[model samples]
Target: MEAAVKRRVEDYSLMDHATQSDPFEFYAALHEQCPVYRMPETGFYMVTRYDDLRQVLKDTDTFSNDVSAKDGKGLQGDLGVLYEEIIAERGWAHVQTLQRTDPPEHSRYRKLLDRVFTARRVREMLPYVDQVANDLIESWIDDGRCEFNSQFAMPMPGIIIAEQLGLGRKDVARFKRWADALIALSIRKWSEPEIRQIAETELEMQHYLFDVFEDRRKNPTGDLISALVHAHGDDEEPLSMHELQNLMHQLISGGFETTQSAIAHGLWLLLRHPETMQRLRGDMSLIKPFCEEAMRIESPVQGLARKTTRDVELNGTLIPAGSLVLTRYGAANRDPEKFECPHLFDIDRKNAGAQIAFGAGAHFCVGASLARQEMVSSFTALLTRLDDIRLEHDLPQPVHNPSLYFMPMKELPITFKKR
Candidate 1:
């Protein structure tokens, strides 16, 4: 009789696409035996089941978002030696932004920013969004083909979010660059030069934001920055420069990276599933749900790290206190227990909204409404302005950064007939 080979958790590569084509399949196998599997490479526990993820996200006391604990070492601890200098020199230990902080402090910063993404504010962005999407399509509608990532997908959210944040349209490229660097840091391995590049970019982004905030202070505009600069929560003082910087970074990256990836991925999904594309083309109103379904299938932001405040037991496994736990939003969104035929990209999915693409609980993405708006508006323009839109390449390849945190299509070449 042949001996069975034990499936050691370390044997799987979380970041390498070469090892696995479908991450959901890889995770599904892992979830079958060990849903809360601890990674040997980084020692971060990954929770793949939908119920467990919801439990961890909701139980703020046991699972802490503010792993930094008043010291920005959370990133350093989760990322190891790569972030040693970043933690010390950059004062990373002190950062407890809305997404990273828990409770009382989190609510304070969240409330101040919440006003900016209110439904009315998002509604106001519709016309500008229509203009941006149409302008991009107009530039390439005649060419019959375009690299959708850089030309259309990347810039739609980039321009809209920049304008909303009181930044110049010319700075959209810069915003995308900074956001890319931030996501790159989540990777386990990088060359010295890459690390230096990230550190330098962080400093530049900080200085650039400093000047912008100074201008906003002196001459306020009806933008998110102005609202952040002037507003004070109930019995709370206005945000300090450091707090504002961290918050601003979160807003820009969250709004830019997540939405851009969704737009690109959504287009690719529609191209791959021509039936869904034809259905959407006919109805037109399905664009909204199509965006949600795309997000559910290929979540832009995959997973995030949280530190345990105390010893916790999940699914027969006991995790020690202070250990880092990674909740797999990508895996959870596709768990069979949560969604029927989870692997299929069903645009008419009745419960597509249940997906945690925007996360859940207190740290849920504040820009969810804005992201949804961008995706719906951009796709609507494409469907209206383009005819017989299809992928230029028979097997359109999706290039993802070798990081588990994000999955964005690197390039999408598609040919379309102008209407």
Candidate 2:
């Protein structure tokens, strides 16, 4: 008998596309041997333990979100330089907003965002969300088979966000391309030509958004873009054009990408676990918990970068000042120390809500509630309208696209009977 090869922390490469596609094994190894691991290829530290990540997230002062300071260290080599040359020459330069700013500076943007993304707004939007879900389902229910990601998952949220941003549902295709371009650099390994193309697309989006912002400012429509344009406290100053542009970039990316991933993965999970699907069909009330567990298992925004403000020791690992730290939310969600049988897909798991899939503390995702509602809406519609959902036999294996930043499935081809 051959001896089983033991895995070491050093054996894993965070930059590899294959590893990014299925990283649970790496997460397990990091959690066991080194919760605070430094990548040999890039020297970036990754924090994997649940408690340690919470601590890092909470201590915003010690762990900053200001990634611009370390510009060249990002995965996109020379892309930042290209961005400056391309964008600054034609349009407004990108500035740090909600996801990239820290402390009092972050507070300014957060207050405005909180006002725009209010709970009442999300509540009011629920009906429309359900309508979109059903409408998309109606498009493919007759076929008894559909490409879940493109046909349903991608467009459902895409149309909603486009309409909310005052662009109307007709522009969803362009909106998706713009959003994809905005996030392309951080998600995967790209060639030099591809990087330039991404930059060009970004410039195109900047110009398009500039025109929209001007229109919203001149005529204050009550859409999300209008709210952002007019939002400010009596004491605070109005946001500059640079600020608004960056905010739009953040909103456009955050509004749909993660939610799309969540919706697709939710159905994929149920298809994989027929018993869970039957249980959810019986009790529909468990849909919320099912969404929570789905996000916990396959977090959409897998890991985000945070720059250390000063030298700090975390779980006995000493990290230097101004170093990049990747808080692996995907890894933390599955830490054996945090959850019993971490790999099991238990919809009834009591503490499933404790997962930091939306992150934690000051920088928690602002669209979290909306994302949850969308997931609930999508799954509820699927269960109500379809039966015996199962993966198509000819479908490709390893469905998920390889991405370091986002957990996007390349495609999900499923068949089901209309109920």
Candidate 3:
């Protein structure tokens, strides 16, 4: 309603450029001048400043997770994206990895999925994860010339998570399709037909998963799906079919994309700085920190869109109720005020351990532990076996998807020497 807010909206709503070029630059501009900007497209406000973002995320009472916000639905700040749209087409079980739910609902879904990522679960899986990574590495070890991204980084986590979920070898092909569909960034802006295509893919995937869930219900295999079938609230309400569907969708999206992107980006980062790689290979102890450091820099998830419950003030910026607010995690991660030499990747940074790649607040990613485990196993297997792992091609530029989430590399071609 204010001229300043209207003017600010015009700049931020140029989704044309934001979806194409480097959005971090745009976010930096927002952080510098208007850290909180209202968007006309979705009628939401976004905040990117370090202090503002931290405050907003932590203020769960004011900023609810169910950005499918109703009363203030048309307000100036809205946040939820990639929810039912992602689930209906892909099936609820697609990713069930967790995002965008308010406390009671999010807590219920998380309880079922969260157990898969426990310390004990992850530690136990490390050997198997390592074996998965090593087996892939060993196959390439003799080949001597391999495109690490496609050959190694992209596929290992898919196989490992699918197996750990007890989906087994039979489900490998469908699992990869789910992973590929989630990560294969559209080179062009997704048009109506493209949206239809995504819808269709979601439907087909949903049907496949529905079948799987049905089979699990009848047979009761005691796997995650079986556990889900049996999981309940204290009130003893069985998980609704819709909730189960959403749960499955989150699992597929999270399990597939995040790990693959982290591994790809981590390897790309290590490859870009051979000196860092050399130093890391020499001192493998540093690899864990290096992985976290790389994630801090090249964050797997880009930004989160949140809708404000009502008119609110953040960092002196007024966000009218019911607007889309993008919490630019990628930009926040690189904020120099938050991290020293934020642009430059440094594994040894003291605060590198504090990045929000898993996000902050009540809705933080449940799969953070799993992703960390996958990356640890993924890198350890590769770094330990490979003699000199380095890039084979020019550093690939980031392929930004039009969607508000995901910072996945289109392809990362690398050539490495084996021991």
Candidate 4:
């Protein structure tokens, strides 16, 4: 595969556009040619193959997840100085928490997160998820039309995460504003002013979470926040205030945005593939794999950054130490070597569960169980409650999130009969 390489490692601009429009094609070419290519412009090594990406993620010792304070993933290197200034002005420490932390800190946080966010806990919340889905559907069912993304796909996860954290449903809008800012910061193209605005908004989010944590400490509502406030690490020392705030932000942003994007992208993919949709609507049992397929085909998170701790070799290519690396999950999921007929939307694909939409290794998404349950409950309610559901806009706009990190339909208007 490496013998036919024609694209240079510095051709990131071309790759960026290709990724935005059709990531599978771009990655397919890379996988067959330069599976482990470095980007000279951004100081990142782009790993597109499935096995190569997995190797980087699993070998945490060799690939440090320690992100720079100003730009953790280093994708936004252009704004590093500005970010440093912002951190200085705001008294912020850009420490890696949860997803970005390497062990033993990653192990410590994972254990604590798992305690509160277990599969059992997620299962217990199924009824609540169903109720939320049904309620959202009820609001628009009688109207005979709805913008699914805005009405259901967007707010459902936000509401669930807010309630889980003991925050009010009324606060979801604020949560979204904060979430949008964080996602924007991850995008490489945002201007310095835009990044500054996000930094300010994040400061606002931090302050808000601080208030909530204090309230949870005093009142002890038994929600996730309260548990986190009192929870002690393996060292038996309680989580510091900074750690508490960082974890809270991660939960809020990760829990709400990614799942919401997944649901939206799932619908977009299904609507475009009616046979798959009809099959899922009929069998119902296929919904799980159907969602899994959607995740693989249009992963909400395109990729995540990892920094090399030491020199590493993958697929016969050697990456030097201290280089930024990007794990292209969107590309890896579509590798034909990993999945048969990677382009097709096959709900019955046996290995659909192997998709790393929620990531893998020790840093796999903690809210995965919760997200899956929410999606299953949502699709169940959506398919059964809306009859003859179809897209309202012909040739609807392309699916793209505001940020480069995510890919989701900006607006998905649809019409259906009230069942």
Total clashing pairs for each candidate: 3, 0, 49, 0
Report every candidate's CA lDDT: 0.79, 0.87, 0.67, 0.79
Off by over 4 Å in 2: 1-6, 394-397
In candidate 1 the C-alpha lDDT for residue 307 amounts to 88
The RMSD (Cα, Å) of candidate 3 is: 5.6
lDDT of 3 by residue, 1-419 (tens): 11122223245443564533356556656656666776666555667667677877887667766554223242211211232344444554333224666666667667766654577877776777777888787776887778766677667877766765557755656876765554332222344445455555666766776777788778877677777776665787776666666676667767777788789888877777888888877888898899889888888776766667788888787877655677777778877678766778788889998887887887788778878888888877777877676566665444444445666566676666666
- Model 2: what TM-score? 0.96
Model 2: number of clashes? 0
Tens digits of per-residue lDDT, candidate 4, 370-416, equal 88888999999999988788989774434564455666567888999
TM-score of each: 0.92, 0.96, 0.84, 0.93
Clashing pairs in model 2? none
Error of 3 at 363 (Å): 0.9
- Sort by lDDT, best first: 2, 4, 1, 3
Runs of candidate 4 with Cα error greater than 4 angstroms are 1-18, 69-73, 233-235, 395-397
lDDT of 1 by residue, 1-419 (tens): 11122464456667566432347656766666678898776678889999999999988889988754234343334343555456347643236779888887788877888877788988987898889999888888888999998899899988887887798889998999887766666645666666777767877777788888889989999888888888875687878888887887787778777888889888888887888888888998888888888999889878888989999999888999989898888889888888887888888789998999888888888988888888889988888888888878754333654566777665888898888
Residue 298 lDDT, candidate 1, scale 0-100: 86
Better of 2 and 4 by TM-score: 2
lDDT of 2 at 239: 90
